[model samples]
Target: MIPYQKALAALACAAGLLTGNTAAAAPDAYPQQPVRLIVPYAPGGGTDSMARALARKLSEIWRQKVIVENRPGASESIAASAVARAPADGYTLLFASDSTFQLNPLLYNHLSYDPDKDLVPITRFAASPFALFVNADTPVKTFQDFLSYARQHKGKTFYGSYGVSNSTNLGLSWLSKQFDLDMVHIPFAGQGPAMIALLGGEIQILFGNIIPSSIGFIDQGKVRVLVVSGEQRLPNAPDVPTFRELGHDNLDTGYTLGLAAPAGVDPAIQRQIAEAVKQAVADPELIKYAAETLSIRLFAEPSGQYRDFIADSRRILQQRIEAAGIGKLDQ
Candidate 1:
């Protein structure tokens, strides 16, 4: 007869294969081992900033290492699906964006895992408004100029996005419908490539986050921001008008980022992690990094309200998708 330990190992392997729940530490003790915090994008972006901050604080508080793993692709759905399939033991968490949880559902035809059923929100961390940027040499200087150029040039113009059906893409789609613009969408593998295309003048404009690359280009006078996608102008860029201030409320959209564990995580564990995140985002260094460097506003809505926020965002995204006639991508 096989030894008891060998038999248990065989059973665990079978369970993993059957349910797609990879091996995980038992939940009774909550994280008795190292925890993985998965980010859907590469390093040096806003998501990485928030994930690293929470990982550091969670590690210190829990006395267990919280590793930040980058799994960038599919507009962050790759990492979200992986986390959704992980064992519900609070050891594997997704540092997900609104694109991962809200937009992907309406964008993709068939997802590997049900986001609502597979992942549970822990805590919301931030909301990042996008900037409407154009090349410095472009004749347009302000949002009004952009509108006039689009109306005059129509289909001759092109815009770039990190991916189709992403937050930026959806926001641009809403803008096109509202303003009757005939611009074309040019997609890139990621934000870095999109930024490169923008600099090369392959695309006329890009609606993207105010990250290091965008900020560097803006400071270098290579590209300029015409508007921001928040209710009010950003403190750093007070001259740039918001969509709301410009009387285009539908274009006033920003993406949200947060941490989530696979559904069925113990309520107590979820609350424990949420409480920890609440403390982490409050760190002076983290707050400074989010605001001064990344230009992202930090958010800390309670878990229940966070879920409501997700639902509301999803509803709005669905309406935009339908109104714009954006088709789902084949998986």
Candidate 2:
């Protein structure tokens, strides 16, 4: 077995081959060479760790080398464009978060790659919800308390997110508009930077994924989660209420970690990739890591369902962008 084949279960969102049955493995002849999985985050972060683990599992399943190359910049567009321009021969795949596809399109007016036209959805590797975290020094404790605090501080309150049109950005923006508050927005290249800002007191609030990277801060009380995204509370942070229970259903859940290949790949190859994802996702250790360590839901959601999610999420994200009155970014 590969050295990291038994590494912790991970987060990955996938849209598999044209709605076909679960594939036990990739087609025998497809990956004759090492497959490169591009991750759009800095090393040592939770997303990068998960991607590396996922790559190892793929190496085992495909019986070939799966290389993970980190290209963390421009809010994932740098790596995305690299994959978009790579030959669509099933060797180059992008492992990205929800924002890479849905949010980046809204933020950048001129992008190097067009997500709709240049990428093909393969299969979702993992899925999770977001949470709102406030710096420990902030006097807010509960969701309602945070709302009241925002209203009290008004323009003085500062919040951080990965970038404009990021779910964290949109989530807080939507909340502020509805509650009639004027909070300041601070955008970072990625969550890791925003997280650091939260810890350093440079920012007071950060809405981030409920992943390993952010969870540690919450555990140490460096940050406090006032609200989560799902209908139910989380395992690690059971004290936090979900946005759904607070009557914010739209923000109930999302933050897909999925796979994608450049556009125009053969449908058969897409299926092969999806099959590998399906097989890897079904591994017991991966499933355990997802439910326990990661506090996420793991599944091999296929391409058709994945497309529906993208279409549905795009509309919701568009509405949020317009409502937030955010100006487009020039990439």
Candidate 3:
């Protein structure tokens, strides 16, 4: 029999060769099977619409089934956690928003998965600017006018946000703190309900996305947009002023939707998914759909850059949540 040391050395050499062969045999052909794109919201919302639009475009590009599954609940926590637990094979992805990877972690006391540790950013698909609107009959015509009226009304100035810890709520809280106003916040199930409450005179102001479904109301003189929260004016509402121009430079909160996969996915597969996403967003049909339906600007940043962006956004949102003193949920 060979000596123990010689036998161990021989075993190590064989193991190394096997490892090299396995690495060389790894397939780079991504999406060999159907890809599941998870949208952490209800089926009819903006997030779902965008996810379906992306899935269609990706299907055309890959010539494979790109399925969109809606898992809506717990402020998008359910869907996010599902994706985090999915296999790290790049076949499953999450179409996430600020609520999932940013706000939920800061606002909840317990989470099934840590976004920073469980998910890897792939790309940012679009950014939807928040619009502050009032009923068309309201005397407030501009941001300045609204501020003046809010001050005079004292606690009577009511603003409707989607929920307590949603982007709309956080943004409205920041604006209220900055302007030294005591506006009462009314939370609704979603932006649709919040806008409905505003239209029915149950609330005076609402912060929401500018979807095409609501454009008719604006054109019909039912809702008047006072200002939009963004660094630049929106193309759909060019005349609307930005919060920065109104002297609230720090009130630039908008919704950014992106794709993320469970961490430890093969880097090559991640790159393939990111490239597919970029190509899908660039397609003329997809661009037209985004422009006409969502009024969202196509802002696609690559996976590496998107990781940095998510990190920065998480920090900013955490600071806001703490400053606003939003109560934590018990998970």
Candidate 4:
């Protein structure tokens, strides 16, 4: 029995109140509280250092606390799965290498979290070449020397990796299959243990990063790098040739570090944080720190471009694994 004009007025008032309450409950902001950046490696590694640097810069930009937590194990699956299950509020992030997304899927028969569905790429900040290294006690001094030695030793030789079915181990597996080189794979909990095994003469070869681990050993003449895996040779190890130069084209992909958030995050929020990361990489102080301390170059790729790059990498890895007949891990 109410007039039309009065009913329309009441409906508008109700809509206004609902909008106000919704805005109050959830601010249309990117980051409203402390952000947690999870790293899938032990503290003091290159990825950890980069994550900390990014955390500091992001905190300054957002004026909010940013925490870096390490959950290293299971070939980075532990930390990655934890982040994947986190709320999609843009507060929890994962800083990991290409291996976490690219290789882990092909390695493990079943994964706790789906890399493609549970996590989305945010951006990539840095990349560096990995090297084929041997302990100083080992008889090999060059790639040729190591290849000859591996062929001669056959199944008796041992190789250590940062983790099972990781990029480091997969590289060895691909090489072993291609050249008919038989070397046992010894997977460690982390890089520290693998480095110790290499240095202690428990393992003869290691496919590892250039920073924090091999640099000190190479400087002290405790480890010999036979080939560097990248497009070009490293400045510090200019004498070392790339895997491509050595006629192994498939091993040319290097290590990459990037940030990812749980899937279903607000697209606007993802862009906001991704821009913050791009700006952070351009900071002069962070550049100096990465070059001097990490012995790696700093680079940045936006979320869209990084996603494409990772897709290409994943395709290549899958093809290589299948071609090599590397079966999936039961665990």
Give all candidate RMSDs, comma-separated: 5.6, 10.7, 5.3, 4.4
Q: TM-scores of the models, in the given order?
A: 0.85, 0.85, 0.82, 0.87
How would you encode candidate 1's per-residue C-alpha lDDT over 23-133 as one tens digit per residue?
443333556799999888777655576678778888987889999998877777788889998988889999878877798888899887688898998888788888898
lDDT of each: 0.81, 0.80, 0.81, 0.82
Model 2, range 1-331, lDDT digits (tens) per residue? 5345333322111333343322533444788799999988777555776788788899999899999998877778888999999997889999967777788887788888899999988887787777788998888888888889888998988888766656677888877887877889898766788889889988888877666877788778888888888757877778778887888785554577889999988788898889989999899998777766666677888888888888888888888778768778886
| lDDT ranking, high to low | 4, 1, 3, 2
Cα lDDT of model 4 by residue, 1-331, tens digit: 8799999988987886877644333435657789999888777556677788889988998889999998988888888999999999889999878777888888889988889999998998888777788988878988889889999999978998768767788788888888888789998766667888899989999887666656888899999989988788876677889988988887665578889989998787888888888888889998887765665678779888888988898898889889778888865
Off by over 4 Å in 1: 1-29
Find the 10 residues in a row with the least total lDDT in model 1.
21-30
lDDT of 1: 0.81
The per-residue C-alpha lDDT of model 3 at residue 54 equals: 91
TM-score of 1: 0.85
**C-alpha lDDT of residue 311 in model 4:** 86
Best by TM-score: 4
Residue 279 lDDT in candidate 3: 85
Which regions of candidate 3 fall more than 4 Å away from where they truly are?
1-27, 327-329
lDDT of 3 by residue, 72-167 (tens): 666677788899999998889998888777787788888877888998888887988888888777898888888898899878888987666578
Which lDDT value does model 4 have at 248?
Answer: 82
Deviation in Å, model 4, residue 288 alpha carbon = 3.8
* Evaluation by TM-score, superior candidate among 2 and 3: 2
